[model samples]
Target chain A: MRRLAPAVGPLLLGLALAAACHPAVAGLLGDGGANRPLSLTRLSDLALNHLTLAASGFAFVACLGLGLGLVVTRSRFAALRGGIDTLAAFAQAVPPVVVVALALPILGFGGPPTLLALAAYGIMPALRGTVGALESVSPEAREAARAVGLTPGQVLRQVELPLAASGLIETLRTAFVLAVAVTAVGALAGASTLGTPIVAGLQNQNVVAMFQGTAAAAALAFLGDALLLAAGGLARREAA
Target chain B: MRRRIILGLAGAAVVPTLLVLLPLMHFAPNRLLTGTAIDAPSILGAMLWPLGALAAIGPGLLAGSRGRLAAAIAALACLGAFALLLAGLGHGAAAWTAGQPPAARARLAAGAWIGASLLAAAVPLGARRVDPAAGGPIGALALAASVQGLWLAGRLDALSVVVEFRARRDELAAALLDHLALALGALALAALVTGALALWRRGRGLVDLTVSGLQVVPAVALLGGLVTAASALLSAAPALRTYGLSALGTVPALVGIAAYLLLPLWRGLQGALRAPDAASLDAARALGLTPRQILTGLRLPLGASVLLGGVRVAAVQALGLATLGALVGAGGLGTLVFDGMAQFAPDLILLGALPVIALSLAAERALSGLEAAARRHWPS
Candidate 1:
């Protein structure tokens, strides 16, 4: 409670902004259509689109990053090892616009490239966290597992991985939050994500629509972040 | 065994480089070098001497002990000056040929000459000792000046470069190769810096600080804010507005992308720094080793794996964000995506998206390799 006081201001401001930009309220009161009733179908459609896009991309990023992190951390090949780090750095340095532009000709517009972009962007945190967590595991515990007649695979699964699960979860949470935030930017590539309304709103100079889109994107990000944090906390508790 | 491992590791880096380049070459236009008989040859000819000079500085500065630091500083200064000179010369020539006033042209010419002269002079002084206190201020100034010069040069008909290349498939291929080369150069520089920093106390702090600053900001919001700020400033400033420089494009987008890419790198660094336990420190100390010996012999070696992890994070993040550079007309894959959007061409979009995805996958593999090497070399 005491530590959270510092975050209160930002939290309140965000909530207020979201409320002010609520699509239902804005559509009814703003200049575009005072008479037009707020439709649930439209809202649900937007929500579904957002969820699908987020889920597919976020899952890929999480899995890829996690697996890469584990393999790199444990692998024995010298060339493969050096190559991995360099590639990761290279991937990160390449701008998202460049990535999308390069991908456009191959993946086509709409969802595929957007998903690829999101996955690439989201992988770093999860990958890094996975590596960090696994490396942080106690050598004594590993030795104990070996002494207890556990094979390498069993030791990794039942002991090392379990111990590192909390950290991995935290990494996933962070990646999820980042993915949610970036999904809105997918509108630039013709994805019907939350950014579509925002871009359209901006172009049309429709403040209400802009607010609605921005609010929705921000709210979704916040909600996603909250859920991740909760998941991380639960994982940590379980680990403890 | 160590030599063999190193050799093998070196060989692996070539595969990804080739993969990225192959596609670029396949799609490259035919007339890339056409009409370059006069200007192109001259540019290439001029570059040879400067490139030679630039190449020599690295080895020269690292030779002696007393003046080593100074030599490095001098080399950097020379590079900075040369970069500025090139930029100023390009702009001055453009402005002069555009029929600018005599006084303005003379001023630009003088500035360019002075910059070039400074660069030429600094190159020979690679043996000079650097004053540690002066290094920070000088480096900051040099970076600022270089960036400003590049920005100016880049703005002067740089769009024509993109348009020209786009007009020809061979040219586009050549340009892609050039871009990849630049990217590789940057990676090599980063690796060198990281390796050097691993050997120095001050270097570690510098690396850590750089990473921390990058990690703190959210990418999208940061981009948005910077774009807004640039637009506001440009609108307010008559001079900038006259130049037709707007924030909605390359500058802000690049800044945003760069900032986003930096976050993972910084976070990784932060983690690496804190990775080692106090117990390890105490144990190393108890073995009767001095602080310097302990750091080099135990701490650093152990920390290498973690540090590389950070490097991996940073690299991947950079690759992904680099795609976004096209949003502001920075070129690369984002250009295809945006072009597709404007024209509503899915094929064009896929063309761009496929390469980026392939690039990402390739990079992911390379980083994984590095991580494994780090683990092996710096095992707990």
Candidate 2:
């Protein structure tokens, strides 16, 4: 049972994705919206939006999180650090869906708000991880930099940041994967991301569109997570 | 040092100044009682926020640790003053429109929004070096000040969101209740599953990996899968339909929420038990405590805080995820948000979004309090 349960989830996910592509299966399940099956092009376009939003949003968030993390970790903003941490985690705890929902009014319909939501979600973990990583840096390294006549800024840039790179990279990897997953739900707000099929399918009772969308998204999420995990591992190895 | 100070001043002034100088508020004749007025900063309105921000910084830089308390006081005062001023402006706007329909209200112009956002930014900027723990209270204060400023001072009451909320008060109330129900229900379900999983300690590593893996699953896809699986089950059994089980309703939504929440609770439980205060357990055993006694009195009591922390995380998570249940027609606050969106009502979206925020934050606070209380009572 122990060996079996781990494999079961992915296997089920894969099977669902595969079944979504089958015309007869989609029909049998009453694939609701116009009873139409998603084409390869449609799936790919959705994936394209999904990837674009996730990549760009993740980049913006990671950078922002890093900066924010740096500021809060500083002696100047010391008092604000715990608040920042709680707020960030609180932001994360508030699901991407709610952010996207609130943002739509200000950002209007489409991919922008989705990207913003992804960024909001991404910032929390990135900030938390960056702080953790920077704090984990040995005091010896910090003292050594100070002894070498390095300014605080210089020490952060030259000594501490590079050493913290692996942990920071891992954080970004998590953020990137999470951003991609969150993007799929952006469809409800009118972004043609992979969630397009799923949201549409759910709305119109089209099981086929729903399954195809879910399958493609699940497959995409798994692929993105695996790639990130690999890249993070490799980066950590090199940094070490 | 001079250059650094100069750069800091520029960084602070740039955004708020542009917000003031530019068209901050856009008013339409129909949207408001009077003709469209953009950036109506009667001499004081324009100076108020910037001056308030400046006043906050001056005291902080002048005083040291002693000044921080004064600065904290100053920060709260600035936020309060700004909120009151903003509220007054909103009231004026509403009064002017009194002759016109109540729905005919002024929309937020660029200045009003950017100014407010800039003001919010200044709240943190006003803080002096103090205990980091104060961040929580300060955060609460800032949030209250800004939201109250926006709602009462800014006349968010006049917005379409409030209008929709007012119109559908019953439904909105129901949605809030529904939202709460789904969140608590899912957390309960997750607790049950995690309890079951706790028996199989050796399988924990795999469980953790699988749970984290699921965390990365796109929410839409997860919902889709649950919907499909439920439909498939109903089709196969036909008897399950009698139990309020369906592909598109509360059951599937509950399942989705439960699955999402399980990860946090299970991990929290596992981590709590893994170490179990070895010395305490040894002492308990030496004291001739029965296995059951240790399990109940020692293991459970010691693990309460850690486990509750997990529950707190899960509770917030469930609260958030429960919003998605609206997509599946499960009737939560998301339904109001989607409904508002479809009708082009921003106010309605807030009607839904605000409650979710309030509930999530409230749950976070409540659970954190419980966790703290449990720890206090437990033998350290």
Candidate 3:
């Protein structure tokens, strides 16, 4: 790694500097053509839409997933696991196009259906994470709790839930990132987000707007993930 | 317990097939002089074979574990009987429309389509995954041959999907092939990258994170990114345009689809190898196995199912994403969808969506079957 970096590092730096200094960089980074390039106002508007949409959708996913996960991990719900796994996997496999298209007719094309689709899409990974992490908790841990004076409910609440919390947070990070990115599809269904320019550009064959939209959306996702990682680190540090 | 599950599944299949077919006009006239759909006298007979198939399962259930042959036969009989009934319905339609005008042909109503799909789904659900009833090559071949034979006999020609297919036979055929090609091209590209990344000993985390991050990018933005990058590349290399590789169409579509595959494929490989655990790997090292020997001898072969699981996901995803390739003029089943959306024709949308769904399901089932077979016979 050390030897290769000496030869490659400066080359990459020079390329980045060269590209940043290119003639098209400004227009490429801007929202669209010179007539209506992205202003500070529009960028903030899109970033707000992107973040809020993801957060709202993520909230629904967290609740639905956590509730369902806790329910199905119960001993009585053992038989339900296979069906839930299949259903969630199926939900995930379904292309967002179908979801948006189908939802448009019933939900009548707006943020609701987009939110519906994102929440639906986001719930599966969270569910799988919660269930998997909970199940991976050893039987000995459960027995030790039982050997203590704790009731079954108390044991699950204090021990299993805390143990599973780390993995669930990671899953939510994934779900949030996914919701933010997938909201781009919602733009096609008439919901305004960072994807507005991307889908519109695709539809109208405008490459400049597309580049800008793509960059903005990617940046939003990057920032969302970074925020999640920082939050996770802070939580871990506080616990430590 | 096995018998009870098998019987329960069989009973479940019977209900839908019966409910959808019975008491309805197999082909009701659109000219319902009244409010309700009034059926012709002969339409009531469509329930006979389905009932017969249901009855066959009764006897099969009693035969127990020894009745593997009986269960297989019952499942086949149900599906075959359902297919024959559908064919017979087609024959009736052809006869009914024999003297009609050239433009006048009877189409299976939506009910018939629903019924047929239920029967198709039921056939698979009826088959238990036990020995002999696991649906072997012979059963698959028979099913394929029968489906083809029905097509040859024009038995399936009366369906609305067939009508739409006939209207654009050449285009639909080309689109189907194009869809397959696009999927394969994307998979090949992804597999190449995944294979390289798997072999690399360093920066695995960085690669995994980047790939996963790429996955979270929306399909639209990714496509846009691809287009932007392609345009930039095309502008930089004017000579490449002379070779028939344009900025749009297959090139960008393949790259876009490939971007989605890298994450799953890489994760699958990493997970599969990691399954052996560090302790086993260390033991292998102690035994003096070279790294190449370890990877080829242990990881790749033992982890075959894990790898295929990723490929299966990739393949199924590619099948659906290939539909989006049509938006860029790559011409796949997605053309049917976008065109249908453009024209606001629901049937045209179904025309596209149904086949894509079928292809995705088929790819998934086939991959799963391959994984099961590999796991059964794979080297330890």
* Model 3: CAPRI class: acceptable
| Model 3 whole-model lDDT (C-alpha atoms) | 0.67
lDDT of each candidate versus the true structure: 0.54, 0.71, 0.67
**Backbone atom clashes (below 3 Å) for every candidate:** 79, 14, 0
What does candidate 1's lDDT look like per residue over B1-380, in tens digits?
Answer: 56544543443233223222222111111212111111212222344344334434432332322255646754674564356335433543343335533222111112222334334334433323354435434544565466575765563332222223344456345435533433344344555544555557666667666654343333444454565568559868859966767777656655565554444444554466566688988887888889889767776677677767666655555555555555434566556556655765433444455455556555664676677778877777
Q: Which ten residues in a row have the lowest lDDT in candidate 2 chain B?
A: B58-67
CA shift at B5, candidate 3, in angstroms? 14
lDDT of 3 by residue, A1-240 (tens): 332233243344334433442325735554434313445466558768877887898888889898889889998666456446655765666666666654553366568878878976777788988888788778888899989888989989777866766676677777777887778878877788878877777776666556556666666665555556555555545444
Q: Candidate 3, residues B107-177: lDDT per residue as tens digits?
A: 44434554555445434433542343365445445556777888898876764446667787787788788
Fraction of native Cα-Cα interface contacts (under 8 Å, chains A and B) also present in model 2: 0.72
Listed in order, each prediction's TM-score against the native is: 0.50, 0.81, 0.75
CA-only RMSD, every prediction: 16.1, 5.3, 7.5
Worst 10 residues of 1 chain A by lDDT: A32-41
Candidate 2 lDDT, A47-156, residue by residue in tens = 77777887888789988998998998888778567547756766776678878877775678898889878887788878988998899899999999999899999999
Model 2 CA deviation exceeding 4 Å by range: A1-35, A74-83, A138-166, B1-37, B42-68, B101-103, B109-161, B275-305, B369-380
